[model samples]
Structures are given as structure tokens and as C-alpha cells.
Target: MKKYLDIISDLGEGFGSYSIADDSSLLALVSSANIACGFHAGDPRTMASAVEKSIENNVGVGAHPGFPDLVGFGRRAMDLSSWEVTTDILYQIGALHAFVKAYGGELQHVTPHGKLGNFSVVDQRYAKAIAEGIAMFDPSLIVVTMPGELAEAAKKKGLRVAYTIFADRTYNDDGTLVARSNPHAVIRDPDTVVERVIRMVNEGKVTSITGKEIEVNGHSLLLHGDTPGSLQLAKQIKNALMSAEIEIRRLGDWIN
Candidate 1:
């Protein structure tokens, strides 16, 4: 396999068989998939099918756990306690794991989805609880987290952390992701996203929304399948990374 970063594709809420767009794009570019685990988007059938497809394409499978908020699409922040967050996360991961196991494939990692992910980065206690829950369930499973804060918290909790960057999102000067509510937060331009990622991987720097240089590290890159033109973006990103001779790997491979 060609050694620089891992790429994961996110399959978002209630995406059933009709998620052909997501399925096709995920199979084509990503080495790993962060599949929605019921709470936010997928049903049992959808989870099973996604796991089967991942196996068929030799892609790594990961549980994408989110708050139980299908109505909000798990985007709205909830006032869940750390215990509640842990339980919600475990429930989602366990359900997805059962499906993957029944299909005779292993779940390689856990990535908190949507609002839960954002909260985990800023709330050390919440991040610790999530990491602890994952470690309790399967110590071998890698925890895919935003680079810096969340990763640091997971590491402290004895969970293997896969520091991730977003291929289609903007960053702030503080190295945190720009809030999604902001107009410039999502990188909609395919060429611009590709250019930014290239600089991040090759130069270890990203130009934040404020036009300030910020240092960042990425073990994996994510493409949100829900975004407009997500499929095209994934294809372009894969091609650009290959042209730059950066190897793409699954989070599992790195953790193992």
C-alpha cells in the first residue's frame, strides 16, 4: 500500500440502501469507514450492509457513535452528563459490533459522531468517559479523535488514539475546528480542500480561517459523506494524495 495518512469516510444519519452515493464514494477512496451506528443514522440492516461492503472492499470498519438524536441529526448539543454520554456511546458501539461480528469482521475503531465529537474535544471529562467506555468494551479498538485535545485526553485514559483531520473542514487559529455554524467552516470547494490537505500533510501546517498559520498533526483524514459533492471531493482527495506519494491507510492498520 502506498504511508502518509489514513482516510475515513463518514456515513451519516438514516442512510439506508438509498445511500448508494455514499457507498460508492466510500468504497472508492477511503481505507476505512466510520459508519453511523443507529443513534444518529443507520439501522441494523444498514449497519450490516455497510459492514459487508467494507469487508468486500478490504476497508476497515469503525463504529461511529453519536447521541440518540435522529431528530436533530445529532448536531445540536445536548446537556448529557458524562455517564449518559458513556452509556449512549457504548450502546451504539455494542450494537454495531454485534452486526460486524455476525458478519465475521472486526470493528477496528470508534469515532464519536457529530455533536458528541465536538464535545469530546473541549470537555476533558466527557472525552475521558468516552475513552474509558471504549477501552472497557474493547481495549484493542482505536479511538479516532480530533487531533490535539481529544487525542491527548484519550491517550491519558489509556485508549489508543488516532488523531484525525477533516479534509473538508476549516480550522481555527487555536487548532480547533471552526464551528459548523460559521459560513466558512465547511470547505465546499474541492480544489481548495485538496490544496489545504496537501499543505497539512507535506508541511505540517494549515492556514486557519483567520489566515494564521497553525501546526497540526493528522493520523487520519475524514470526508463527511453528507456534505454536498462529497463523493467528488473524496475522489479528488484520494487522487491528490496519491500524486503526492502519501500512503493512505486504515486506522486499524495504524493501531495494530
Candidate 2:
């Protein structure tokens, strides 16, 4: 059997006239796109453009919901009730899905953004709330998450889960991502990132910050569009995966 891997990137992370990353270039290399909804780094125009571009590229369009922290880029944690989290997620997903619908495409999945994503991994309440929001929106939507609280919650909700690993981020010994506050949390070397991803996809293991090999059943590898030299790196990673005989595909097509 041929091993499959999906490369996804966060996109439409621009507001008004200010843009971040070359979405057009990144879209060409990625198999899936996690389009930012209006909460953190997107607006109505940006969302619609992202959806249309993603559809044109034949990429899977997933909603990337974040906390309403535009200044902080949704990387800062927020204090909110479970109802708030669920409702906020539902709203964000709905807003993006509208554009997808207008573009004659269905949403592929949901991946929480930044701090909300980090919290959902460790906090069960947040995990359950996010799962509830996604299920409420569409039970058929795949939940792209790490192996943690959110994964468990999504599974219990009968939602298909696509376990993901960040290609540019480092992991802790316990399987959670290392905090971005740590200077070494993100690995910028393209060669190293490609090597690690190949290993993780083929061997189901990733090396943590502590240099410990941690097992991870990853179906998707996430790349950040905003990272410097990211476009070239994404190309290299895609080439490396192809060279290694791994199939690069959209998650919605195969994840079960």
C-alpha cells in the first residue's frame, strides 16, 4: 500500500490592506488550506478570495477559527466560557463556509487557530466545546488536531479526526507543541523540516525538544505560510515527500 500525506497551510491571514505571506504561491504547493475566518486575521473580502483561490487550485478548504484577538493574532489565550467558545467557533466556521458555498465548494475540515488550538489540546473543557461547535456545524467535517483532548473529544462526537503535526514547530516530551515563546520552538531549516516530516509520516515518530522520539500517528503535516522562506521550504518538503514515494493528497479524500 502507498503511504499518503497531506500538506496544509494557514491562509487568508490578512486584514484589509495588510497582507501576510504569499497566499497565491503557497496555495500552489499545499494540498489543503486552513482559511482564517474574521476573528484573527481575515475579513470578508479576504475570506472570499481565499475560498475562490482554494477552489481554483482544487485544494481542500478548511475553516481556521481563532479567538477574537486581532492585535495578538490569536496567539494569546483568552478567558471565556464554554458556551462562548462553542458559539464563537460556530460563527467563524459559518462565515467562512458561506464563501465556500458561494464558490460552489463544500468545506473540508476545521482546525482551530493559534492559542485556541493550543488550549484545545490540553484543556478538556475547551476540547469538548470545540468538538461541540464543529459537530453542531457539520458532523461530516474532519477535525484536524493533534493526539490530545481535542482528538478524544472529536472521536467521541463521531467526527472523523485527522491527526496533524506542525512541520515548522517543535514538540514537547509529552506530545504537545512547544510554546512559541521559546526561541527554539520553531525549526526554520528546510532540510531538517523535510527530514522530520518524512520520518513522522513513514515511521509515525517525531523528535521532541528534549531529543526524545515521540510516537505520532499523523495524517497531515502543517506548514505556515507566514514563515520566512516558507514558499521555498514548502516546495522542498513537497518534493522530498514525492521523492520518498509518499502520496501527497487532500485530507478529506482519504482520512477516515
Candidate 3:
């Protein structure tokens, strides 16, 4: 545990450039940043600014691609063909990579956001499509995915996989996240979030909403920057992990 913790911050719609939470404190606490790529939120300017800030803070930058549903904020599921999903991913990654290159930085990873990520996990064909898209873009780029299903698919496709877990979210008995629509899904309490993360890192387990302890292989921990009290929770999570002898680092440093 002391050598393998990567803290990530999700920069979504509610916490874009126009929001109060998009600032240095959040950037400082996180080692990897998932920046929205215009589908769910963020424009060209916001993406460029976020990329610049991430580089300035020496944090790893990744593209946060989502469904093309601005009205739904990419949270609502949509029926998309595998090819369509693959093309969407390529467009989003290309958009962010251009900004990163302009700033003399590299796009380190790709994390599908919202409904796309949820659907990809349960649908192996969708997962493979996403993996192929990432592999096509650059074989060296890592794919940050939900720890179990999508990560396995990406690995099978020979893409470097970053198995990600969420610090501010609840898990199901099978290690999938409790649906966001559920009342217990989002862990709003900072102390609880810290404790859950520590247990996941040290014991390789997460207590699900049903009180079942499920095994989890978390290569990285995600903190949703748009969630209420997210920055405070991130600080507490990092401190607790460090106290427990877990060393937090960027995902790029761990990927082969």
C-alpha cells in the first residue's frame, strides 16, 4: 500500500472554469486530473486552461470523454453503436491532446465519463470498442477504467490499464459502484470517504452499500471535483492514506 496510490480529480460540468471549485487547491491535492472534453461540459478555452494548470502543478492530464448529451450532462444513458462510441472517443481525445501538446505537455490517459463509462463496464463489446479507440490513438496511452470489467477488456486488447476506484462513491457487493440515483451512492461525508479509501488501499476491500466486503484492485482513486466538499474530502483522503503508509502518486508513474 505504501507504494501504490494514485489520486485523481474529476473536472466535470458543475465544476468547470466557471465554477468556484475549479482552482489550485483541488489541483494541488490530486496527482491525476480528468478534464471534461466538450461533450458533457467544458469548451476549448476551459480545456486549454485546465491543461495548462495541470502542467503547472506537475499533475498528469487525461481526457474525460462522455456522451454527446449536454442537456443531460452525459449522465443519462444513450444508445450508441460501438463504432459511434469509438469515433466519439477519438474526437474527444484529439481535442484535449491538441491543447496538451500546445502547452508542451502530453495526454497521459483516457477516462470515459458518465453513462459511457457505466455502459462500457457491463458491455464487453462496448469496452473493446473503447479499448480499440485508445489503442488506435496511441498504443502507449493508458486507459483509466473501472477496476474490474473494463480494465480487463483493455488489458486483453494490449492497452495499458489503470484500474480506478472512486473515493467519494459507494460500491455494490460485486465491486461495481452503487447507482448514482441511489440515496447512498455518493459519499458526501469527508471522514467516511477517507476511511473507505484507506480500507480499499490497505485491505484490498470496500464495504458495499449492502454491508458486504468486496475485493477490489484499485490502481487509482478518483475524487469527483464537482461533488460538494470534494476538495476537503480529497485532502482528508490523501492524509489518511499517507498516515496508513500508502504513497500517493500519478498513474503515469505506475503504468508500464
Candidate lDDT scores, in order, read 0.82, 0.94, 0.83
Clashing pairs in 2: none
- Give the poorly placed runs of model 1, Cα more than 4 Å off: 15-21
Best by lDDT: 2
Per-residue alpha-carbon lDDT of candidate 2 for residues 95-135, written as tens digits (9 for 90 to 100): 99999999999899999999999999999999999999999
When 2 and 3 are scored with lDDT, the better candidate is 2
lDDT of 3 by residue, 164-243 (tens): 88888888887788897898999887777888888888778888899987888878898877777777777888888888
Per-residue CA lDDT of model 1 for 1-256, tens digit only, reads 4456888887534555445346855676889988889887888888887888887788888999988887787888888887888888788889988988888889999989888899888888778778877877987888888765567777876778888888888898888899888999898888899999898888889999999999988888887777778887888888999999998887776564
Q: Show the colliding residue pairs in model 3.
A: none
By summed lDDT, the worst window of 10 consecutive residues in model 3 runs over 12-21
Question: Which 10 residues in a row give candidate 2 its minimum summed lDDT?
Answer: 218-227
Q: Would you estimate the TM-scores of all the predictions?
A: 0.94, 0.98, 0.95
* Residue 59 of model 1, lDDT score: 87
